[model samples]
Target: MKLLLASSLALATVLGGGASAQTPPTRDPAQIQAGTYAVDPGHTQVGWRVSHMGFSNYAGGFSDVSGTLDLQPKTPATSKLSIKIPVASVTTTSDKLTGELKGDQWLDAGKFPEMTFVSTKVTPEGKDKAKVAGNLTLHGVTKPVTLDVTLVGAGVNPLNKKVTVGFEATGTLKRSEFGVKTYVPLIGDDLHLTIAGAFERQD
Candidate 1:
């Protein structure tokens, strides 16, 4: 339908960002300083992949996603995330396709304009990995989804001198679950999602 579980791994990445900031001494979530972090509006995105018949795969993504991360330093496993993804931001490299996505048979952005994901639990897998589970709401239906998350990096941005955290998350979802079953088994019932973004320290 549309993308952005952009809130997707926020559950995944929310597991963990300042200036005059020194380089990140350690990549460990616990080692890194903890505080509330803001998801970078411009640097974050939700990538979607679906099958285009048996011949090929069609891929696209959503942009302009925004979110917040509340990280618990000592217990990184308790971190929480909230993210918002607007249906209007979907892009598929084709104006016609993009239009179809926003129409009634697909996303129906006019009525339900936003898709959201809010983390309910974050379980640490190891030093840099975690399993984040959350409720995903799309097209007016809500479902539980889990993501596999890995911390990509954590450091101070040299240009801004602020602490930042980066993460990569992957998950699978069924577009039909949300009521956007425009194309059934032919197009694809499952959609693989990739969410990558950086969160900036607020405190």
Candidate 2:
């Protein structure tokens, strides 16, 4: 019985030492790099809301957005973003409204094909929040805009083993300032924009 007990103790000691000998789990190196990344259109969307006739709000979205994001996961305050949304990609459920939005009175898609935003600075507000200051160009006019940005989170893509980051940002723009002044009181001058984007790290 004593020999058996000694044998069990020796086995336990060997197992415990083996467990301690193993290397500690480490995070992905690619995640640490956090370089320039491209927007995955399939996983990104740009949405906007504006008042209609001063009574209700009308919501719409724009497809065909392209962008580049410069990220430093460890230093999010230094990150940068630049995105372009084609005016012609605007869509509404109402066919009439959709046509009108693409006409001369509104976006005038034919004349101005794109709206762009370029970030100038990023200020950290909290652990997952930031204030992004940028220049937004729309309808041939450029104006400074501020967006409240929140980092949704980031991780490795299980299927591809690539690093991906998600973010949510919101901002407001005055239509009149961008030459989108069609109806002064009828349509609200304030346009609220929400952006959700997922960026995939590039090799």
Candidate 3:
């Protein structure tokens, strides 16, 4: 098998050489070119957690999340983020529990089929961080909320070879404030939300 061995060795050497020559470009979130980007729904997540009578924390997530982001890297205050979450896409551990959560006693998904957030302002906390203030409409009520946002990074996606940016945001809202007072104090009036979002350049 001398000929086969030589061919394999030569192929390995060529691949190794190519690998050594390619270096991932430096990632600088601040340098992300200004553009309109669509949030990659498949790579994005919307999760929420609530305390259950101080005994346990229940958590769930939503899918079919869609959004668009217009970024102004140079003037972050001008950037905007808008997202719509289908209440019917709620996911939990049990199918039965999911049904209960979507009923009139809770989210009332039948009445309000969707929840949305539109950023009204972006206040820079520091480099790569910001306080995003937005109006959240849910369960037939609207309230102002502020998300503590951190830029995870921005770079070219190796798989698709497209410019991509990611972020993690956390915020808290009072369920009662949104007219969702099913169990109130027992179910915990506050709901914590964590969003992991990815956006790709559109133009």
lDDT score of residue 202 within candidate 1: 94
TM-score of 3: 0.89
Judged by TM-score relative to the true structure, which candidate is superior, 1 or 2? Answer: 1
lDDT of candidate 3 over 68-126, digit per residue (tens): 99998888899999999999999999999999989999999999999999999999877
> Which runs of model 1 end up more than 4 angstroms from their true locations?
1-26
Counting clashing residue pairs in each candidate, in order, gives 7, 0, 0
Better structure of 1 and 2 per lDDT: 2
For model 1, give the 10-residue run with minimal summed lDDT: 16-25
Mark the 10 consecutive residues where model 2 has the least summed lDDT: 23-32
Estimate TM-scores for all models.
Answer: 0.86, 0.82, 0.89
- Candidate 1 residue pairs that clash: 5-8, 9-12, 17-201, 18-162, 18-163, 19-161, 19-162
Ranked by TM-score from best down, the candidates are 3, 1, 2
Best by TM-score: 3
lDDT of 1 at 34: 82
